[model samples]
Target chain A: MSTTLGRISHGAGLILVLCFTLFPFYWMVSSSFKDQADILASPPVWFFTPTLANYADIFADEKVFGAIVNSLIVATLTTALSVLLGAPAAYALARFEFRGKSDLWFWFISNRMISPIVLALPVYLLAVQLRMLDTYLVLVLIYLTFNLPIVVWICTDQFRSIPSEIEQAARLDGADQFTIFRKIYVPLGLPGIAVSAIFSFIFSWNELLYALVLTRRSVQTAPVMATSFMSGYELPWGKIMATGTLIVLPVTIFALLVSRHMVRGLTMGATK
Target chain B: MRKGGEFVERTETRLNPGYGRWTPFWFLAPAVFALLAIGIYPMLSALVTSFRRYNITRPREGFPFIGFENYANVLSDQTFWQSLGLTARFFVTVLPFQLLFGICIALLLHRPGLGMLRSLARVSLVVPLATTYAVVGLIGRLIFNRDFGVANQFLNAIGIGGMDWLGSPTGAFIAIAVMDIWQWTPFCALIFLAGLSMVPVEIEEAARLETSSKVALLRHVQLPYLLPGLTAMLILRSADILKLFDMVFVMTRGGPGAATDLVSIYIQRVGFRVFDMGTASAQAILLLIMTIILSRLYIRLIYKEIE
Candidate 1:
């Protein structure tokens, strides 16, 4: 009887936790379909006449399409630059012995620890001086400090997992360093590169501070754009939720699709 | 034959002379350059700017050297101290619950015979982890809304009085903390699950056979394996919570008499909103110092464990 009670309690607890976890997401989605009156109605509307007006108003008035393009451009550039630069460094760290090797590795890892808040002022000042404000280039470059370290760190582990003999054999067959990297290492390290790329893209896509500071009108990201919807007079609840859902949709989809890979990549070298 | 072989070896050595020694640098050069230009240069510039009084509005004078005056001002400022206290409170209050929930969920998911449920659980939990802070802030705002919110409705249903979530100091702080917990608990759980997987089954089975109690098995076998993960989660989450900005900025904008204002939010306001660049830079430097100290303590503790 005690064991049966224990089992029943456990099952109930699981259901409660699941509900608690999923309710916010459900609310967000439900409220997105709600009109302003429906949203502000007392006692909260669970089932509502779903409307596409919020989404339509968001797209029509908010210029979210432009923000999406900006996000895509910035994320793409950041990912490409991070991977192109980071993969080679990761390979060097993994395969080759050199002076200050451990120091170099630690230095890269420590870069991740440096808060972006510290660098914000200088980056702002620099952006103004260079006249790179509101450009995709500046945001991508600013994102590199955080993203590159992660890429190199993740890729280093991936490269180290591959045997050195494979690269050596390729080199022995008159393959140049670049050739061996392209033919052997790149193929082996593709998954790591994919994980690193996804992380870089997500970080850039979600970034708000630099986007807020640097861009005034032209290069605002989705997050910054979403913030502009807030006025002291009246909060546009429907539009904000609609835009919020749109902003998260891409990363959410990407995350769900590549979740298994992300889990493996993140957990790499973490257990031991 | 020996002489011919020796000559061939000599030729091979000369042909490949120092190739291995120089190859790594060639590969590392691009990443190193990027890091230096983007990472190190900006940091050094910030360090220099912290010591100088510069207003972007007044560009003609060019950042006059202030010689610790900004630091002195920031040190004495009561608001700064309050912000620091608020940040500390935020960190201490939220971290313990996040850790506990994370561990409990990880344990639940780690149980055998939950095949498809486990994957579904992971997917559902990880959705919040992938969501951006801006969206999270919006969600929190909606959930904690005074009149139309689901939270107040639930409270009313349970016969509890509805309180203003973002209108008061404690309410606003709790709202922000709850949002953070919602967003980050899954991350902590993932880390704990990874750590738990490393726990040996034999030890757990042995403990179970001996004691036949779940608490006994966890205490004797699983807890030791979980310590590293717990330490890591604590250190990482503490560092991140100290730097909390996006949610606070979105939800309350540090309102209700600056009660919810954290150090990072304060720095942003002083720096950007007020355009007190030197004061802001000094505040940032102070924050950086505190973070470095905490990180060092964490590293030392982790190293002690390893040793």
Candidate 2:
């Protein structure tokens, strides 16, 4: 009887946990398909004829589409650049005996923890002064502050897990440091690099403050554009929900694809 | 002596002349350069600006070097202190629940059976973890809508009156905190789950032999074992909460008369809304100091406990 009671409680707990975590997502997506009236319906319209008008409207809007493209471009570039720059640095940190190596690693990791607000004005001013405002290049470069640290930290941990004996053997052969890094570390560290890439991509994609402040019209990303829907006196619930869904879709997919590594991704090199 | 000498000689001759002292530097160069440009340089510029009268509006004045004036002005500002307090309140209020819920859920899922349901619960819980903060804020607004929100509907069903979740100051704060907890508790759970996986089965079984009860086992054994994960979760969540901008911005925009005005929101206002660059920079520096101090304190505390 006690065992049966335990099983029932466990099942109930699992369902409750799932609903609490996933209901917001369900609400967002479900409400997106509802008309403004249906969306506002009290006791919440659990059953309704779903419509694609919200998606249709968003797709038709030039500004929204432009923001989507901008977000895609920025997220892609940031991920690519962060990996290119961070992997070698990570390898060096993992394998080499260098002065201030721990300090360097700490510095890198600490950079990830900084509030974006601290960097916002300075970066904004610098971007404005350089005529780089509303440019993809500037945003991509600035995103390196957060992304590079994560990449280096994760990849360092990744490379550390791979026994250094392989690299040493390659060194003993005629392979140079660069060759060994490219041939051995890159392949071995591919999974970590993928995790870093997904994280950088999602971060760049989800970023709002920088996207809002740094760009005005030409370079607005999806999150900033999503906020624009909220600025009017009357909230565009349908449109905002649609935009929110669109913004969340890619990140959700990327996160799930790398869900196995999320514990490592989030905790950095601290845990497994 | 011979073995030591031979080892030293072998190490000295291990790498060809090509891969020398500068090899690591060369490897680290790009990331270093990126960090220097993107992180260090901007930080220094912000630090320098904090000490000067660098108003973005009054560029013609050439940012006269007014030592300690900006800092003094920001320190005297009541809103600065209020925002700081609110930020702390948000962090303190929401973090414990997240940690608790996280540990609870992790413990639940860590149970021996209910295999498929356990995996399903694990994956579904991460949905919120994957959702963007701004998006979460938007979702919160919808669900907490006074007239037609799902929350009010649920309250009505339970024979309670509906409250204005985003209108009243206390209500708004609670709403945002609940939203934050909802989104982040799963993150805590994931980390704690990872930590639980690292806990030795032998240690657990030995501890269980004495207690023979789940609650006692958790309190005596599992909780102690989860300290590292707790620390990491605390440090990670605290830093983000202290700097929370996007969520609060989207949800309330520090609304109901700045009741939810965190320092990040205040600093943004001072910089962008008020066009007071110097004061904003000073505020940012102060915030940076607080974060570094808090994080260092937590790290020291966690490590001291471990030792």
Candidate 3:
């Protein structure tokens, strides 16, 4: 009887926690479909005739597509470059013994620990000097500063986990170091690469501060575009919510789908 | 000495893939070069700029080296201290709550006989983690509005009454704190859960047999594993709080007053709003030092070296 009571309370607590966790998300998505009047309704409308007008309003502004295309371009290239450059370095760190290896590893990871403010002024100046402001190449290069660390750290851990015997056999088969890395490790470390790619894409896609300062109209990202709609007295609440939901959709799907990997990604591979 | 050295060399050749000394360099060069050109070079440039009078708005003044004047100005600025204090206050406000709630939720999910509820709750937890931080700011704006917000309606339902969450200084601070907790508590929970999952079933059962006290079991059996994760959580969270900008920038814009003005926001104001890059760079370097010191100390004191 006592055990039954405890179980009941446990279930109740779980439900309460679930409600808190999902409530704001529900509110955001529902409000996206709301009209102007319904969005600002004081008591808050629980039930309403949902509409596509807000989404239509968002796309009606032609810059929205350009912003998304820019985000796509930046995120894709960032992911590619991170994996391409990171995998070989990760293999070195994982497989070899070297001087200052730990120092090298820490230096890579500590890059993320530096405040964006510290880099923002300098990066802006460098861009102006290079004449590379508001370009896809600039954003991709900037995105790599932090993303490369993530790729190295996670893929290092991943590469470490794959047995050394596999490499031994590949080497015995007369495969060189590069051949072994490509044939043996790349296929085996796909999950880690995918997770890192997802992380790089998500961060690059969602990042706003650098994107805001660096890009103007040409290479403006989705998050920047979302914030751009946020100015003035009569705020476009419905459209803002709609654009937010759209911006948030892919990440939410990725988060829910690969939650285990997402946790590892989030904690910078510290947890897993 | 000769025997020890020879023995070490034998094992090194066996385990080290017998590659040339420069092989690692070949693999590492591109990444190192990229980091230098993009990351370190710019940071060095910023470091040099911090000592000079380089305001973007005032080009006529020229780039004159002003020695420690910029640093002195940052040290003397009252708003800079106030912003630093607020940043500390913000970190303190949300951390304990996130830790407590996270551990409790993890413990709850770890409890047996709720497999169905467990899976569903796990998925829900990642939603906030995945949501764009700026969108979270937008969400904070809608939900914490003075008159037309669900926060007020819920308060009324609970008989606590509604206050203007974003209007008053204390209210705005609390508003940002709550949003931060909402977003990051899940992260803490996820980490603790990862720790808890490592606990052996036999050990947990053995502990349970000794006493019906969950606290005792947590203190004795589960805590050892959780400590490593906790240290990691602390390091990341401290760095994150110091650099926090996008969410608060969108949500509060450092607020109705200076209530939500974190150091990051303050520097942005200095650098972007005023175009005073020199002082801003100085401020950034100081914060960067603090971040490095805090994280390095955490790693040295407690964080288990990742193998």
Best by lDDT: 3
Winner on lDDT (1 vs 3): 3
Q: Order of candidates by DockQ, top first? A: 3, 2, 1
The best candidate in terms of TM-score: 3
All candidates: DockQ? 0.54, 0.67, 0.73
The DockQ-based CAPRI class assigned to model 2 is medium
- For TM-score, candidate 1 versus 2, the one ahead is 2
Candidate 2 chain B: worst-modelled 10 consecutive residues by lDDT: B298-307
Label model 1 with its docking quality class: medium
lDDT accuracy of residue B88 in candidate 3:
89
Q: What tens-digit string does per-residue lDDT give for candidate 2 at A1-272?
A: 99999999999998888888889999999999999889878768789999999999999999999999999999999999999999999999987776898778777877767899999989988998999999998889888888998899889889989976787788777799899989998998899889999999988998988887899899899988887787767777988899899999989999888888777776665566
Cα error, candidate 1, residue A152 (Å): 0.6
The lDDT of each candidate is 0.80, 0.87, 0.87
Q: Estimate each model's TM-score.
A: 0.93, 0.96, 0.97
Instruction: Please give the C-alpha DockQ score of model 3.
Output: 0.73
Error of 1 at A145 (Å): 1.0
For all candidates, what are the clash counts? Answer: 0, 0, 0
Candidate 1 per-residue C-alpha lDDT over A68-149 given as tens digits, one digit per residue, 9 for 90 to 100: 8888888999899999999999998887666898668766765655666787888888988999988888888989988888
